[model samples]
Structures are given as C-alpha cells and as structure tokens.
Target: MDDERSAVFRFLRTEIFPGGEMPGKHDVLEYSEAGGFSVEEIELLRPHYIRTVDTWAENLRANRERAIAIQSDEVYDRYLRYLTGCAQLFRKGISNVGRFALVK
Candidate 1:
C-alpha cells in the first residue's frame, strides 16, 4: 500500500476501531488450528466489502443532513471519507476482507 492509503487505513483503524487487530490469513488459520478447529472454507471478501462500503457511502450521502444532525458535519464527513477509502482499498486489493468457516 502507498503511504496515503496506509495512512487512511491507519486513521480508520485508530479513530474508528481503536485497539482492533487485523489478522492475516495465516494468523487466522494458525489460531483456528490451535483451537482444534478445522478450516472448511476461507472466502476472500474484498469484492463484497467494496460493494458494502460503496453502499454505506451512498447511504451516508443520501442521509447527509440527518447524519450531520445526529452527529456533526465533521463526524459525518470523517465517516464518509473512511467508507470511501475502504472501498478504494478493497477495489485496489491494498486491503482485504475474509470469511472463514470452521468446524470444531
């Protein structure tokens, strides 16, 4: 990821999801195995997340006045930017989302 994209992800991680951890595929696999769970499927969900964020951004724009009223313009704008950045990252493959199915 480029510096700007990394910065955007970092900002989202820190400001929006404080103390949250983004684990890699290997990390997830290892943890699941250690917990005696077998991985049945691992689905890469970047495309889905891209669509999801796009929808969120569109909804935010549609409800801009209400969002700003509920929070502030700054908060609304920040979240909009965060959603936009997330979509971009997912589309460009700079970031990814995943779903894992495990059987214990």
Candidate 2:
C-alpha cells in the first residue's frame, strides 16, 4: 500500500471521497465473521478499475471543453486529477478494488 500521506492520497481523501478509507481483505473477512457471516469469495478488481479509470480520464480529456462549460474549470481539473491518480495507483497496486460474497 502507498503511504496515506502521499499527495495523491491526500488529495483523494480530502477532495474526492471525504471520510473514505480502504480496508484490507483480512479486515473485511474478520468484520464479516464477527457479524455472523462467512466469507464466500473475494475477487480482486484492481485491473478492471484501472481500465475504468483510464477510460474515464480519456473521456474527460476528450470532452474537456464541454466538461468545463457544463461545470467549471476547477471541477473538470479535479475529476481529471482524481481519475488519473486512481488509475496510476491501481496500476502500481498501491490501491485495490474488489468484489466480495458473503453468506449469513
């Protein structure tokens, strides 16, 4: 995992998803078990998310003028920064996304 104090992390925490935190797989498993659920499966989706973010960044760039016109230069730049940063983080494995199945 990347340092939480990293510029990208700080920007994301403060601007994009306030109060959001990513928990480790073990943390999720333990929490679920404590709540009387069994972990059925966990599927990592980091690669998919990287692709998704990359596509978003591309689309944002393509529609840069429209985005800025519809929103604001600040908003357009912020989202572009967020999407590109997320894609890089996912590519480097510093961030992860997942799908989980639980049985109660």
Candidate 3:
C-alpha cells in the first residue's frame, strides 16, 4: 500500500497533470488570471481540487495507521519502510506545489 501511494502521486504528476492543457497553463499563472474560466468552472474545480486533496491525505493517514498496527516487530519494520517511502512522496508533492510553509 505504501508503494501504491507513491504510484498514485507518480500517476498524478506524469499522467493526470500533464494529460490536459488546463492544468499545464494553470501552473504558470495565478488561477484567477487564467482565462476561459467561467465562474461555474472555478466553482466546480474548487470542490474537485479539495476532494482530490482530501482523498490523498486520507490514503496517507490510513496507510500510516495500517503500518503501525502490525503486531510483529519484523512486519512492523517493513511497514515503517513503506511509511518512509510514502513520506518522501508527500514531501516531494508539497515542494512541487511551491508550498514552503515554514518561511520566516
């Protein structure tokens, strides 16, 4: 499941993000400045992006919990490895979005 999560992000980056022109152009400009957006499109995409993020977050939370719940030490350690791999993907995604939250 940990590898699965990384695969999801990889798919999002390589496949879904570049699969269309909208997200491509949206990346460079403030979303508001990107033209051809009706109020309705903006409204729809709001929930869309929110829901997508929610799904991603939930998957990460569940996988982390699943890893911690394994009883055997050996199995637990394996899950911890998976957890680290998942963390790397999350960190990469946050960086990709230019969301450096700790700026002083």
Candidate 4:
C-alpha cells in the first residue's frame, strides 16, 4: 500500500515538478490550473476508491496469516481497521482519503 501511495505521489511530482525536485514559480501556476483536481472530481472518483479499498480490505482479511508474517499482528490489525474505516467514511461521504483538491 505504501509503495502504491509512493507511486501516486511520484506521478504527482512529475506533473507539479517537471524540471527539478521542487516546484518553481511557473510550476506553481501550472499547479493551480492542472496539478490538483477539484472536489467534483474527487466525488466522481470516490466510488471507485471505495471499491478499491474494499477489495484490499477483503484480500487482507483473507490473507491474515501472510500479512501477520510480513508485519506484526498489531500492525496488520491496525491496517485492516484503517482500510475498513476508510471505506465506511468514503461511503458515508464523511471523508475522502484521496481528496487532494484545495477547497476554494
């Protein structure tokens, strides 16, 4: 999961920082226009995100022993609870973990 998240962040970095590791003034303008998405986009993507997390949670549940072997029982349990809770929050519209758009 962390690797997947890192990949996403790297993708964003490419969009927001083309030349170097940090954003320049021109990059900032680009970011304002195209770097970040909007709430409507987030809302549109929420269901898909929920479905993905649901699958991940279910898979984790099914492979509990392997997960425990990879990490500690406490870590495995916490991650499972987190994924489950995130799905519920997304379903209820209480939170959107992937909502990176700045509210304006």
Candidate 5:
C-alpha cells in the first residue's frame, strides 16, 4: 500500500541525510560500490533497489490512470511532476533489471 510506495520513493532520492539512518546488517551503517556494504551486500541491495523501482513505477502508473477518471487537473499535474522526478529511478530500474531493451 502507501507504505510500500513510500519505502521505494525514499531510496531513489540519491542521498542519505536529515534522519541520519539507513538500512544495513550486523551494525553496519552504509554501503555502496565504494563504501560500507561490501561486495555481497552491494550486489543484493542493488537488485532490491531496482525491483523496488519497478514496483513503484507500476503502482504509480496504475494509480494515476485510475485518478485520471475522476480526479482534477491538479492531480494529473502532480503525477506528471512525480513522473519527471522519478525518471532516474525508472531508467535505472529498467536498464538494470528489465529484460527487454530497445536499441537506438
């Protein structure tokens, strides 16, 4: 539901700040290609992040379509803004995990 959507949304922001908290195992604080999670954790979280993007995109599209039928222009506009903001996450998701690709 909303919680799942929020979880995915936060990961796409590209930086950790403010709350100063993040996901990790065994008392670790962070990870990246150049940081804390180590090779295995990085490999694992990478796929999960991509999957989360795909999930969020599908849900957002579905929700927006439904909203189009009975919602105001503002709702439509907001979703469009959201779509733009999420472009990076979507592109990364598909390139990293989606099987089909179009060459151009």
Candidate 6:
C-alpha cells in the first residue's frame, strides 16, 4: 500500500512541480503543515495511533480462538500475521496512515 501510495505521490509531484525543487503552487499541504495542524497536534498523532493499534492487536489476540473456529487455522494465522505486521510497522515508525483531504 505504501509503495502504491508513493507511486501516486511521484505522479502528483511531476504534475505539480514547475521545474525547480518544489511544487509550482498550492493552497494547502500535508497534515504536518501549519494549514492542517499545529505542531503539538501533529506530535499527538503517533502515540494516538500506537495506542489505537495496540487495542486492535489486543482485540484480535483475544478473539483468536473464535477466529480459528470460524475459519481455517491457516486463514486465522494469516490474519494475525497481517495485524502483527501492521503493528510492527507503526511501532517502529516505519510507516504511517492518515487522511488526505484535497479541497477545492
């Protein structure tokens, strides 16, 4: 997903850039920018998502038995692995997720 998102960003950069190092023009910016959020608010996002993902991992862990019961063991394990991979990425700061609003 991140790779695909990066490819989209690359496409946008080509369309938006005039010639130099930056975009030609813009009315808004990424969430970390002043137009989208304050520094403190941006700082809060990481820990908030960490806690959120932790809760999700806990719920998935607690429901493991039911998961396996409803599905095959392989499917259940795969789901758990997927959750763990996501948690690890966020926990390690290797990835992030956010809402991108491009307003007219």
Against the true structure, whose lDDT is highest? 1
Residue 29 CA displacement from its true place in model 3, Å = 24
Compute the lDDT for candidate 6: 0.55
1-104, model 1: which lDDT tens digit per residue?
A: 58977798689788788899788899999999999999999899998899999999999999999999999999998899889988988888888989999999
Q: Tens digits of per-residue lDDT for model 4 on 1-101? A: 55644554464355434465634334544566684533333324678889998999999999999999998898787778767766775687754444334
How well does candidate 4 match the true structure in TM-score terms? 0.53
Error of 2 at 65 (Å): 1.2
Candidate 5 Cα outliers beyond 4 Å, as residue runs: 1-46, 69-71, 80-84, 87-104
Q: RMSD per prediction, one decimal?
A: 1.3, 1.9, 12.0, 10.8, 12.4, 10.6
| Alpha carbon lDDT of each predicted model | 0.90, 0.89, 0.45, 0.64, 0.47, 0.55
TM-score (C-alpha, index-matched) for candidate 2: 0.88
Q: Candidate 3 vs. truth: CA RMSD?
A: 12.0
* Cα TM-score per model: 0.91, 0.88, 0.24, 0.53, 0.29, 0.51
- lDDT digits (tens) for residues 14-104 of candidate 2: 8998999767788998899999999889999998999999999999999999999999999999999999989888888888988889999
Ranking by TM-score: 1, 2, 4, 6, 5, 3
**Candidate number with the higher TM-score (1 or 2):** 1
Clashing pairs in 5: 31-37
Q: Considering every candidate listed, which one attains the maximal TM-score?
A: 1
TM-score of candidate 6 on Cα atoms, chains taken together: 0.51
TM-score of 5: 0.29
lDDT of 6 by residue, 1-104 (tens): 67844643454345334253422112224433655543332122555677776787689789988878898778776656555655665676655654343433
| Candidate 2 colliding pairs, count | 0
